[model samples]
Target chain A: SAVISQKPSRDICQRGTSLTIQCQVDSQVTMMFWYRQQPGQSLTLIATANQGSEATYESGFVIDKFPISRPNLTFSTLTVSNMSPEDSSIYLCSVGRDFTEAFFGQGTRLTVV
Target chain B: QQQVKQSPQSLIVQKGGISIINCAYENTAFDYFPWYQQFPGKGPALLIAIRPDVSEKKEGRFTISFNKSAKQFSLHIMDSQPGDSATYFCAATMGDAGNMLTFGGGTRLMVKP
Candidate 1:
């Protein structure tokens, strides 16, 4: 199990504004991922953040909309650029450990007004 | 293209009773199955997981039943309690544990006391 700390537990922002969520882990991990959970919907993979490389985003999600930065093994940031009502969702950071277990942070809840 | 499908969008179970959530996937290459429990205002936590090598795996009062041939898996919560009330999501992934995970629609379980 891993302990993750996510910043800005929640926030309500005006539409068209941007918000950046931060994630910090207790230990260095090989893989870190970003996920989005919309209201009353399932979790969707947004991108995979690997240190020293570009983030690989899933289809339907582009880097221009959601930019990710993995500066180190234990820290990562996700910025929701040009936010809109449709981007209101819970953003989570997950860390993979030992090739078997994946642990998640508390998540950042973003609400666009 | 929803690769995973979950049933009973919501569930209600009495205390000490059992709660079951089912999920079916379309991908045959998926080998890792995991169950996540998310409380309001929090990230989804890893509850239990099972690989295709085994048919069932149990951790504490939570169990995961997998059927590789059917491309399906289910989560069973025994002795359900009010504390267990939350949203449950069943996810599948190929390759490593924290790779791009495909999540189900999610089941809101209310364990009534």
Candidate 2:
């Protein structure tokens, strides 16, 4: 298992503003993923970040809306661009470690006012 | 189309009881099914996982029962505890999908003391 951490555990931002959530893992990993959880709903994969490559976004999500950066194996960042009231949700970072098991961060709770 | 679907949006169970959450997938190509448990204010942690080659896998009180023919899987928590109260999610992915997960709507489980 990997120890994952995310900065700004909770943030309040205006609807027109954007927020960048940072994810740091204690060890190097091959794949880092970003997801969003709408209240009372399942987590949706926003993008998958690979070191030195552009992110792979899922359907209904795009890089312009959710840009991702993976500078290295242990660090990644996800920016929710042009936030809206509907963008208020919990953002989480996760990665697979040892075999196919996956683990996640504490998550960043964003409230767009 | 929703790749995965989960039933019982919410459930309440008593301590020492059994908790069952079910999920179904539409893609036969999906080979991995994983269940996660998330506490409030925290990201989801891997609870149990099963591959298509296996019908059932258990870890302590958590078990994953998978049926490849039906493309269905379920999570069973035995001797449920109050600490088990949280949101549970079932996700699937194909190796060729670049590891992007297709998640079902989560089920909220509340275990009473």
Candidate 3:
């Protein structure tokens, strides 16, 4: 089992601001992913954070909007570049270890006002 | 098009009853199927999973039935309790290329006592 942690459980941010969420894993992991969950909806994959390489983003999501960085195997960061009411949602970071199961962080809840 | 599809946007079950959530996938390339459970304001946690080679897997009170031929799978929570109320997501992944996951729409289940 892998234990994951996310910083700033929640925050109320104003529009046009940016919020950077951090993901930390207890053990070294190969893959880390960022996800966004809109209100009353399922999770949407934002990007795959690969250590020492550019994050692989999903369609409709761009690096300029949600930049992700994974400098090491145990840590990653996701930045919501510009905040908006529509961007108010829960951001989650997940880790896949040995291709067994995904372990997720507690999530950072951002409420863009 | 959505790669994974889940049914019963919401469900209500009585205590000691059965809670069932179903999912289907359109991608034949996906080799791993997993179910995740999320409480309000919390990130999703892996609940159970199955591979294409397995038809059924049971862990405690939760069972995953996989139908590889139909590209369908379902989660069954036996002896449902109020503590089981939460949002459930069924996801599939290629288990390669960093093991990125494609999530289904999700199901909200409420087990009443």
Best by DockQ: 3
Q: What's model 1's overall lDDT?
A: 0.89
Measured with C-alpha atoms, the lDDT of residue A12 in candidate 2 is 96
lDDT of each: 0.89, 0.89, 0.90
What pairs collide in candidate 2? none
1 versus 2: better DockQ goes to = 1
The TM-score that candidate 1 achieves is: 0.95
Candidate 1 chain A, run of 10 with poorest lDDT: A95-104
Screening candidate 3 with a backbone cut-off below 3 angstroms (N, C-alpha, C), the clashing residue pairs are none
Docking class for model 3 is: medium
Off by over 4 Å in 1: none
Model 1 C-alpha lDDT per residue in residues A20-107, reported as the tens digit of each score: 9999999998889999988889888889899999999988999999999999999999999999999889999998876656788888
Each prediction's DockQ against the real complex:
0.64, 0.59, 0.66
lDDT of 1 at A74: 95
**How do the residues A1-113 of candidate 3 rate in per-residue lDDT, one tens digit apiece?**
88999998999999999999999999998889999988889889899898889999889999999999999999999999888899999999999878768888889989999
Residue A8, model 2: Cα distance from true site in angstroms: 1.0
Q: On residues B1-53, what C-alpha lDDT tens digit does candidate 2 reach at each position?
A: 24799988999999999999999999888878888888889888878888899
Give the per-residue lDDT digits (tens) of candidate 3, residues B33-113: 889999997889889889999999999999999998998999999999899999999998886644578899999999999
